[model samples]
Target: MEREHFSRQFDAELNDIREKLLEMGGKVELMIANALLALVERNTELAVQTIAFDHEINRLEMEIDEKCLEVLARRQPAARDLRFITLALKIVTDLERIGDQCANIAKRVKELNLEPALKPYIDLPRMAQAASTMVKEALDAFVRGDENLAIKVCQDDQVVDDLNEQIQRELLTFMMSDPSAITRAMRINYISKCLERIADHATNVAEMVIFMVKGKDIRHTIA
Candidate 1:
């Protein structure tokens, strides 16, 4: 009876940690969306709010790390359970970094808003959307233990990369044409790079999920 009770408690603790990770993922996704919205709409208030949201993401990351450590010390989980806990620790770090990228993008947006409008902002928003979708799907795959969905997330990263490259090219053209537009163009370039980095982090999370599900280390393997 005591053994069964201990098993039940351990499972419950793992489940609670998983839920917290998902909650953190959701908040990060919103931060990305709002950051892009602020840039496209020139909404400084929304940009400020998005920057403020990073505090919660940072806090949750610390809390999740503590829970994972407690589980490792007390439960001494093995096999897949052990893998899950370690993956959770890694995922939270990626999520926290994604939050940082969002904050960076928000800060750039505020700067851009003070200046006159750049171009139509066509590619940056698309890149942000793709990166955010990858994050949401990757987290969903982790929760559902869906290896295929996670693989899809890895595949989707190239789209964001391509968009980022296109934005850089377009912005470079703008800077070449008008010296006065150089500062604004560079800021937009930085925002594009931030979104691309967010996608890269999401890819990292998806790779970890694939490892957790298949017991295979497919980090650098071709899709």
Candidate 2:
């Protein structure tokens, strides 16, 4: 009876950690979406709010890390339980970094808003949407233990990459034609790169999810 009670308590602790991680994931997703909206709509207030929200993400990361340590020390989980805790630690890092990228994009958006409008933002928003979807799907895969959904997240990264490349080419052409347009072009280029990096981090989480589910390390595997 004592052992069963301890087991139940351990499971509750794990569930709490999972809930906190999901909360962090959802905030990061909102940051990504708001950063793009601020850029496209020239809403400086939203951009500032997005930047401020990063502090909360950072706090949640620390809290989650502490919880994982507590579980390790108390539960001494093995096998699948051990894998899940370790993966949670890594996933929180990626999510925090994703928050950083969103903050970077928000900062750039504020700078871009000060200058004249660049060309109509066409591909950048699409890239942001694709990257955001990957994040949401990756977290869902983690919660559901759905390896197939995680694999799909890994495959979807190409869509963001292609859009980023196309945006860079278009921005370069504008800079080449109008020497004065270089400043705005460069800012847009940096924002595009941030969005691409966010997608890469999301892919990292998806790869880790695959490892947790399948016990196979698939990072950098050609697929």
Candidate 3:
């Protein structure tokens, strides 16, 4: 009976951790969407909204960290549970960083209003959406303990990287063609950099999922 009680408590704690992770992921997704909308629509209001979300993301991250520490001290989980908690800690860091990047992009969007948009914002938003989807699906895979889905998320990161590079080249061409576009083009360049960072965060989440499943680090290891 005592063993069963401890088991139940451990499961409950893990469920709580997953819930917080999902909350963080959802907020990151909103940040990305709002930031992109701010860019495409030139809406300062939406940009401000994305900036606000960064605070909430940071708060949730702290709450999750506290809960993880409590579980570690009280439950003393081992093996798979230990791995899950460790990975959750790392995942939250990546999620929080992604939120900051979204805010940075939104800030850039707000400033771009003074100058006409260099282009219709074709590739950047698409790449942000794809990165957001990868994050959502990767977290879903973690929730379900579905290693196959996690693998899919890892594969999707390559697509995001390709899109990011495409955006860079296209923006460079614009700056080269029109000397007047240099300033706005540089702003767009930073936005693309933020998107690339988001893709990197998504890849970090994928790496955590792999560690959770296979009990391997595999972080710097090339697949």
Candidate 4:
């Protein structure tokens, strides 16, 4: 009876950790969305709020890490359980970096808010949407153990990459055509780069998810 009770408690603890990780990922996804929304609507207030949200993400990271560590020390989980705990640690790092990227985007949005928008933000919103989707799907895949979805996330990164290159080229043309637009164009380019980095982080999460599910290291092996 004592062993059974202990097993149940251990399972509950694992679930709690998983839940906390999901919470962190959700905040990151929201951060990406809010950052882009601020850029599109020219809402500096929203950008500031998005930047502030990062503190919560940081707190969650530490909280989740502590939980995972406690489980490791107390339970001495092995096999899949060990993988889940270790991967959880690595995933929180990626998620936290994604939050940082969103904050970076928010900061750039504030700076760009001071100037007239360089263009109508044609591909940027699309890029942000794609990157944001990657983040959401990556987290979902992780929690759900959906290997196919994780693979799809890995495949989807190319779309973000292409959009980034296209944005850079267009901005370059803007800089070449009008010296006055250079500053705004460069800021916009930086945001594009941030989104790209976020997508990269999402890909990292997806890759780790693949490893968690199949016990295989697919990093740098996919595409």
Candidate 5:
């Protein structure tokens, strides 16, 4: 029954990690949504609050990491269990970075609020929605052990990238057409960069899901 006892403990640890990941995912989603809302609504107060929540995301990341390490040390899980722990570690890192990106967007929103509106709220919010959707899909893929869903997330990254590029080009045109628009355009540029980073983090989550499922590192492959 020794093996059975170890299996039970291992499963408990894994379940705990999964729950924490879900919690982290929920918080990050809220942060992203709030950050975007802060910009759209020009609410500096909400932006600041979103920035503050980032610290909690960092703390959750560390806690999840510590638990994963504890499981590794105590159980020495092999095969799929090992993959689960490894993928969890990678995923937490990506999620934490996504949190930072959300904070960065909030910071940009604060800066942008000091100036008059550059243009109508259009592409940036659309890009944010797509990025947030990708993050949620990637997390759902992990939860359901669905490689197809993970691959879907990976495929969606290109749309975010395209949106980023479009935002960049449009901002460039704004700056070029009206020299006075440079300052506001620069803030939009930074916001697009933040969205781009979020998409990258989503891609990282997809890669981890693939690794967890296939036990092969496809991180280097361009798709």
Candidate 6:
């Protein structure tokens, strides 16, 4: 009876970790969306709000890390359970870093807001959307234990990479042609790089999900 009770309690603890992780993931996704929207609309207020929310993400990372540690100490989980706990730790770090990238983009949005419009902003929003979706799908893959969904996330990362490259090339042309546009173009380039980094972090999470579910480490290998 005691062992059974302990088993249920341990399961509940694991569930708690998962719940917290999902919460953090959701916040990071919103931060990315809000930051990009602020950039497109030149809404400095929304950018400020998004930057402020990153503090919450940082707090959640610490909270989840502590919870994982407690579970490790008390439950002494092994095998799949062990993998889940460790991956939870890893995922939160990735999520937190994603939040940091969002904050960086938000800061760039503020700077760009001061300058005149730079082009039509045609490809930047699309790239941000793709990156945001990758983040959402990666978290979904984690919760569903869907290896295929995780693999798809990995595959989709290249789309974002390509968009980023395209944006950089266009911005380079602007800088090459109009010397005065250098300031605004460079800021836009930084924002594009931030969005690209966010996608990279999402890919990291997806790779970790593959490890958690299949016990296979596919980090350095092509997915």
Clashing pairs in 1: none
Give RMSD (Å) of candidate 2 vs. truth: 0.9
**After superposing candidate 6, which stretches have Cα over 4 Å from the reference?**
none
Model 6: lDDT to the true structure = 0.93
lDDT, candidate 5, equals 0.91
Q: Cα lDDT of all candidates, in order? A: 0.94, 0.94, 0.87, 0.92, 0.91, 0.93
The TM-scores of all predictions, comma-separated, are 0.97, 0.98, 0.96, 0.97, 0.96, 0.98
lDDT of 3 by residue, 1-223 (tens): 9999988978998999999999899989988999999889999998988898799999998999999999999988899989889888888888899999999998888889878767797788788888889989878977777778877888888888899788879888998999999889889989888888887787778877877888877777845
Q: Candidate 4 lDDT, tens digit per residue, 1-223?
A: 9999999999999999989998898889889889999999999999999999999999999999999999999999999999989988998999999999999999999999998877787799999999999998998998788899999999999999999999999999999999999889988999999999999998998999899898988887876
Q: What tens digits encode model 2's per-residue C-alpha lDDT throughout 8-57?
A: 99999999988999999999999999999999999999999999999999
Q: Which portions of model 1 miss their true places by more than 4 Å?
A: none
TM-score, prediction 1:
0.97
Give candidates' CA RMSD values in order. Answer: 1.0, 0.9, 1.2, 0.9, 1.1, 0.9
Clashing pairs in 2: none
> Going through the candidates in order, what is the number of backbone clashes in each?
0, 0, 0, 0, 0, 0
Q: How accurate is candidate 2 locally (lDDT)?
A: 0.94
Candidate 1 Cα RMSD after full superposition onto the native fold (Å): 1.0
Q: By lDDT, is 2 or 5 better?
A: 2
Comparing 2 with 3 on lDDT, the higher-scoring candidate is 2
Lowest lDDT block of 10, candidate 5: 214-223
How big is the RMSD of model 5? 1.1
Tens digits of per-residue lDDT for model 5, 1-223 = 9989978877888999999999999899999999999999999999999999999999999999999999999888888988888888989999999999999999999999999998888988999999999999899889778899999999999999999999999989999999999988998899899988998899889878887888787877957
| Per-residue error (Å), model 4, residue 72 | 0.5
